[model samples]
Target: MAGFLELIDNTLGTHFHTPVYDPQTGRKKILRVIELASKQHNEGTTRAPNRSWAAGNNEGISFSPKIDGKPVLIGGKETNFVHKSRFQDFLKGLKAAVEKGDLDKEIKAALDGDAAPRASTSSSSGTRSGRNPLSNVRSSIGRSLGNGKSLEEAEATARANPKFDAAHIDQVVAEAKANAK
Candidate 1:
């Protein structure tokens, strides 16, 4: 049985690990999915920042493990493999490292650098002047009509302005028409 297991080990690598769970919440330290992928067409500087490689019966497979969509960089470079047969062994080693918290610092840095929440579109206050742009359009149109400019002139000025987009123009025009009546 030992020899049989060794033969299997030679064919495919091994990683013996169980993830650590928090005592209070029953949550794994790494909440995201763990994935290993093969590299493909990484054509650019550093050749595709997110490339990985694995092949069937093909040597020189690359391995970059991702946790929550972030690659765990080692020495500032992705991990690759020349002996393709060692794929399973490498995978097991990666899992063991995760279990041992050997990659926590690297993982934390990756997550921190990303700033996931701020990158999301749900934030209404960024890039633009801290206020909803539509409100600015509303005020502009109101001021134009208030300043003795005829509706036609005000509408023409709004349409001619390049700073506003078509949708905003349309919205403000509709509101102006409504308020004029």
Candidate 2:
């Protein structure tokens, strides 16, 4: 529904100005907006996020209709609405907000029971965590090999090789040193 989509955009545009914890609040807000939009548009349907869709994905929000065996109308056309990726972009923006700590004030406000509106602004930064030790080793190997393969590929290759285990390599090196002595 165009109204639902517009509500999503407006809510995101507003709520995204301030940060919220868990990203689920943003999701819930989006759902509430969709519900209001459905009411405004005279549709007898409810939209809520699908949890099963988030099993392995890093980001994105998937919403399903509450009413069963009914087609959702968009632009005066009836259609089978399976799932909608509603808050994917909004989640990305919220992630950026979290990383910049812009969300701390907003989260505190929410926890403090204040329902003030949010304000939009630019200029934010984020920091990424360091790589794992094994992944770092894999990256080093890949770099030395002069190939464009990723660290995961190098790690997989090393893991599949029979003689590539740490203890095995140490044993082999010790045996060679003893033989030379």
Candidate 3:
């Protein structure tokens, strides 16, 4: 059920709308809100942006059933209007649809073909392994100061790296001076 929900989320975003076209008139018509579980609509946790399923409110896990820009009838009443206790039933229905391969093939293909977003970095190899670049530079500056290389040479080494800004260089220099004692 979780896997099916994840696949659906990756294909069609949590907050997205689809445009309904008039087949007889052959023109684009109403914009229908498909799946809406917005954070702004529900009160959230202090740490999290929205109410999680495990936290009692199923707003995060609930997915609405819409047809012709309106809620579909599940048990004589609109599915969205139903009480929150029936959220498990809604998830089961969604899982069944996924198992029957009711999702659009084109959307699945597009999602599968796209690459994941890359992390931003100055180094050619992008690895943020919890090491501060400034600290490394500072250590190198301290080493240089210990090796009898003048303060100017240590500053030059710090300046050569594009990652080290003016403030970073100053911090490194101050650390190097402190380490000399």
Candidate 4:
């Protein structure tokens, strides 16, 4: 069982870039599994980070467990497989199961628990709401700087233009340099 858990952990770790087991207990951690699932959910779609591995869908991953001589499909809400808040409890339960050699029962219980909360759609909504307010300022400044203008031209313009403040620029530069280290 420990070997099986280690195999799963290594397989998952390669794909997810995160640890997937409780080292002390030699068990697969449920929270880590949930995190991997979440990453799979968000990787690859129109999502900015584009990490959805199984298409653009957010449907929770499925697991099959043999409990009491019956094979059960653990998915949807009963799995609570994607809920972030329940991660710690899930990990604890899984560790306990591994220690007792009843992984099958623990897996079944997780799969049969209350449905996890639906994944949020805020990323899509935020992207569509409009460009960030700061973006407008950046664009305006970029335009004012003009295409292919030399640094000398910019400096000359700043010196000749009343609106350009060299003192403010120096202060900003100084502050940024101070904070860089």
Candidate 5:
């Protein structure tokens, strides 16, 4: 349940509606909200985004289901990713159990959580530090080109210097030429 709920929590943001041509009539313009996931609902359009199901991580684990700040264990191991159809079957089992009040004792125990507080985890990726590596390389290449050196001369000079990577020099040189164009 935590996996399902966290999927919703991670995808929230504000967005502006983009006007697209109505495919049905092809005459009227309608506001369309492009979705990467269960994200911002702009004005009126509501639709589910198309996605594919796959594994949880590189460790080859199955479904990782957590409830009430704890991991669910299956056969003395934390549940890992499984195929979607299999997971749906497991959900059906859960539904049946809930209908018969089979998990009442376990649910009560879970609600009465541990006395110790859990430390929250945080991630620091997926965002830029506002610095671009392109600016540095482009500036140096531009200065070399401005010094009246030929392409071959620049290539040879870079090859002699251990600081410049051989494989990337060609790309940077090509980009420098493209910028000139």
Candidate 6:
């Protein structure tokens, strides 16, 4: 299972950081939906440097877990997956749903990294910034993904990009996948 998780993370660059088995009890963590999402893609970076607004604020809503062997939960509220075997499959389904555009507004927003509340801009604002918000992030992920270079070459190129991190590359890919559809 650990090898499988590592393979997924390496190939797709995703952060499925949930501890499926406890260290002491050897059982999955008692996780709520929000806790799950936060672990996968928690908020830290912001759209603007000075602003507090960030993306993925409503990320919790995307966690659609099947409990008690049914794809249903009451009140659209919190729940858990008690059965250990179900989590891996559930994550695969969630990824498929995002890839297929079967997502709620909040999840869509979180996926796009644009769900954070925005401050009002001046009505007279006319100047266009030359920078694309995702250029650096895209480049970083690209470098980590090999960028047409051999594995060894890609590893070397990855070091040149300061924004690159293994888990972060995963999150970026996940966000890109969400936005692609």
The candidate that achieves the highest TM-score relative to the unseen native structure = 1
- Candidate 1, residues 1-181, lDDT tens digits: the string is 5677555554233434634433222113232223323213222122444435434355556555444555556456545454655655665566567667776666665554441223234333222334466765666677788778987787777777665556876888887788769
lDDT by residue for model 2 over 1-181, one digit each (tens)? 5677555545456666675456455334434434443443333232323321221144332332211222222222222222233344443444455455554444444444442322322112111123333443444454534466544454455556543455443444344346548
Model 3 misplaced regions, further than 4 Å: 1-128, 179-181
Instruction: For model 2, state the Cα shift of residue 127 in Å.
Output: 42
Error of 1 at 97 (Å): 1.2
Q: Looking at model 1, which ten-residue stretch has the lowest summed lDDT? A: 24-33
Give the per-residue lDDT of model 3 (tens digit) for 124-152.
43223345666667776776776788998
Whole-model lDDT values for every prediction: 0.53, 0.39, 0.45, 0.39, 0.41, 0.39
C-alpha TM-scores of all predictions:
0.34, 0.20, 0.28, 0.19, 0.27, 0.20
What TM-score would candidate 5 get against the native?
Answer: 0.27
| Candidate 4, 101-156: lDDT as tens digits | 55544454444431223243344321212554233333333444555454444344
Error of 2 at 178 (Å): 98
| Model 6's TM-score against the true structure | 0.20
For model 4 the TM-score comes to 0.19
Could you arrange the candidates by TM-score from highest to lowest? 1, 3, 5, 6, 2, 4
Model 5 C-alpha lDDT per residue in residues 40-129, reported as the tens digit of each score: 222222232322122344523244333444433333333445453354455455445544555443333333432223342211211112
Model 2's lDDT to the true fold?
0.39
Ten-residue stretch with the least lDDT total in model 3: 26-35
Top lDDT model = 1
| Backbone clashes, candidate 6 | 2
Among residues 3 or more apart in sequence or in different chains, the pairs in candidate 4 whose N, CA or C atoms overlap within 3 Å are 42-51, 42-52, 43-51, 43-52, 44-50, 44-51, 44-52, 77-115
Which ten residues in a row are the worst by lDDT in model 5? Answer: 25-34
If ranked by lDDT, best first, what sequence of candidates would result?
Answer: 1, 3, 5, 4, 6, 2
Q: Is candidate 5 or candidate 6 better by TM-score?
A: 5
